[model samples]
Target chain A: MANNLNTRKAKQKTLTVLKFVFLFIYLVVVMFPFLWMLTTSFKPSSEINGPVDYIPNNPTMENYINMLVKGNFGKYMLNSLISSTFAAAVATFCGILAGYVISRFNFRMKTPVYLLFMITQMIPSFIMLAPLYQMLSKAGMTNSLGTLAILYANMTIPFSVVTMSGFYAGVSNSIEEAAWIDGCGYVRALFSVIVPLLLPGIAATAIFAFMNSWNELFMAVMFVDMDKFKTITVGLNSLILKYNIKWGEMAAGTVLALVPTMFLFGFAQKYMIEGLTAGSVKG
Target chain B: MKSNKRLGQRRNIFIFCMLLPAILLPLIFTYYPLIKGGVMAFQNYTLMDIKNVSWCGFDNFANILSNEAGVDFGQIAKNTVIWVVVSLALQFTLGFALSLMLKKKFKGAGLYQGLIFFPYAVSGFLIGIMWRWMFNGSNGVINDLLMNLGLIETNVGWLAQKETALLSCMIANVWYGIPFFTIMITAALRGVAPELYEAADMDGASKIQQFFNVTVPSIKSVLLMTVLMRVIWIFNFPDLIYSMTSGGPANSSQIITSYMMTLVYSMDYGKASAVGLMVIAFLAIFTLVYMGATKYTSED
Candidate 1:
């Protein structure tokens, strides 16, 4: 009996070692690319060509300079920043107010409208891809960054509503009823009572909108033209196509594209989990 | 009292009017695009040269189906299936396991959750580029690391080679997708009643046994919904394909979206829209199946 217990303890210890080993390896697997991208961003031109040579004997910042200075990184970043941020802000504003109405209203067609908004999220983005490109192009809205913002806002509002509606459901109706009885109108109650309660939900919805627009490549790739209008995804993609084998510059540009979301995610780390999980698990 | 009721009715109408913008946007932007695509599929159009238009009917699709017409779209369709299924299986399996790990309280659990979900926030295009760099043939990190470790005798050109290309794409895709399941499943796990586990424990059931009997059933609703949504997403999105390989190594990994993009860019509008139509058809069928299954399962 003593021997069996001792052996079991030893086995458990071995399991701990194996479990940690697995985790460590998985971390390496995930983080390896990020590390490599960083390394590749500084590699000299000669060493950038091969399969097994991401590192350079003589590292340089020349590639980074070339990418930003020559490749319009500032313009691209600014374009993405302006368009995506605009989209997020506009979507959040309308989405929250509308989500509140849908949640609290006893109007006709409420369920259908909500269902329509829900289904919008599930439609293959590709089905809309060509047509949106066509229609927007015809409208002459494709060229402007504002057009991109509108497109982004349109894509994100469904998701924003679905998640935000769920959140408003959680934000007790009694509070709003109290405000209603105090001679506050529905709009005033929504603005003063319900809106404040939905701060966390709005934050999550904003993040989702921002992330969608930031990561958006299809719209960016299809519509935008000229150097000044290229968002980061399209810009980096075009950079790679035009300058194949320019490893450092490509890496630098890609990393630059990654920064905003990385910053946002880091700041609001807690809500990313709750916001994504809530609607996701529920739906 | 009569005036108050009238006021209430008026308020409801006003509330709905406020929802008009949200409603109108999707109607125009979302559904209109789909309707446009439905029509556009029938016309030979390159907006760049819209003057030289012709009606192709279903000729684009027919050519692909007949194969003698030499479009080779059958290959693209086959690749789309492979991309979706392979990704779905891997993400579900790994995500399930990761969620299982997170079910237990641990030191730095928050940090672990944060790290795991970080990939989901990383842009798909960047994931494509990051993987492309890692899979770089001669001087890439994967080869370098493997060579240094003395694990492999030769450098493997992961994304560049036909055989390895789709699998390499899957590696990055799986990374991006796993976090989604983990987040959803973990949330489900939180909602799972501890009473079920307690009862199972009283029966002297093993931990693994309790997991299967209690945990699985409890999270089944969440599992069903998340899986449905995920299946739809992976089937539709070919973004990784666009960025990673661009349907390269002889179009071996050309999912439908990438194929459609190539055709459209080259002004084969009739064929591209036909391909786009095929994707919509698939999605429509898939959504029907998903909703049917959800309704069916939930009923029982």
Candidate 2:
């Protein structure tokens, strides 16, 4: 009996060690590209070629300065920020209403409304590209950041609605009922009572929507033709197209583009994970 | 009592008003374009000559299907299949393995999870550029590493050659996809009941057997759904391919979606719309069949 127990302990220890080893290797594999990009971004143009060093020997901010000044990456960054923020904010606003109704109310058209929202999540955004471009061009809205924001909001709304509804479903209605009994209107109760409770959910939905718009490439590329109006992704593509081989500048630009999402992810990792899982798991 | 009933009706109207933008925006932006795309597929539409846009029944589809435009629709379809299947298979396997590893909590797990999941938030376009630079034949990090390790004497033109361009793009895609699988499978694993594992252990089931019986069955629905969703996403994902190769090296790396992008770029709206419609129809059919199969199996 003692021998068996000893063997079991030994086996458990081995398994634990194996797990750590596996995790370490996984971390290296996952982080290598980002680390390489960081190092390469700092390297001077001359040192970017030939044998690569894991660490930059003479790191300089020239690449970054060039990207901001000559490459006009600052303008692209501003464009992305405006579009993503606007889209995420508007989508979340619409999502809160739709999600609340779906979760808290039952109406004659509830089933169809719910199904419509769900079906929207399944369709690819690319299918809407050609026609959306056509429609926006007809309205003379093409090549504008406002049009991109509207399209992005449309892309993000379905997922945000689903996520917000999931979060709302978890909150009990007793608080809202009490608010109502105390003479608060539904809107008042929602803002003063339910909104506070759903802050984390709201954050999650907004982050998801923001990330969607920020990272989206296809729609931005299709809609925006002018360099001044281009978002980060499209602007980067233009840079690559114009300059055949500028690795340092490209790396710097890529790293700059990643900063906002990375910071957002770092701060709100829990909410983002919760939101993503909630969205997918419920489906 | 009558006033209360009227107030209730007012509240319903208020709720409907609140929901108006949610419903109408999708109808206008999403469904409208979809319908327009369908209509445009049957017409000889060109952005350059919008005044001459007229009905051209089945011609656009035939043009692609018959390889009339030199786009080689048949090869593109084959490449699309290969791209989706290979990427999905590798991603799902790697993701599942990573999830299983991450199932049990350990030191620094949070940090590791953050790093792993970070790639998912990065734009596919940026990822393509990063990988393209790394795969450059003359002065790429990959070649430097390989040469230093004495693996190959010469630098490989990963994205320059027809034989390796698609594979090179697939590697970047796989890297980008790993996190998705890990995030999803890990979440699903968390939902698995602990009691099932204990019960399996008590029944003298081995670790492998317990995993197959308890873990797989519990996360089956999530696994199926994520896989199906990924398949559709991958089919429609053109950013990485567009940025990396632009379906170049003689269009060997071009998948159907990127081909559609190329068509759009060349102002062939008719062909682009037709391709878009075909992709939508294929996804609809695929989703139906996949969901039906899963439902049938679950019943068993």
Candidates in order have lDDT scores of: 0.79, 0.86
For model 1, give the RMSD to the true fold: 2.6
Taking all chains together, each candidate's TM-score versus the true structure is: 0.93, 0.95
**DockQ of predicted model 1:** 0.58
Q: Where does candidate 2 clash, by residue pair?
A: none
State which candidate has the highest TM-score.
2
Residue A226, candidate 2: Cα error in Å is: 3.1
For residues A126-226, what per-residue lDDT tens digits would candidate 1 score against the true structure?
Answer: 65777787688778887789989988999888877766776777777899899989999878888888788767778878987898899898788888887
* Segments of candidate 2 deviating more than 4 angstroms: A279-283, B1-8, B296-300
Best of the candidates, DockQ: 2
lDDT of 2 by residue, A184-213 (tens): 988898889998998987997898899889
- Residue lDDT tens for model 2, B1-300: 999999989889978987898888899998888888889989999888989999999999999999998877888999999999999999999999999989988778888898889988887888888888888888888888989899999989989999999999999999999999999899989888899999999999998998899998888888887898799889988889988899888989999988988888787888888988888889899988988877833222
> Could you tell me which 10 consecutive residues in candidate 2 chain A have the lowest summed lDDT?
A118-127
**Candidate with maximal lDDT:** 2
Regions of candidate 1 where Cα sits further than 4 Å from its true position: A1-18, A50-57, A280-283, B52-54, B149-151, B294-300
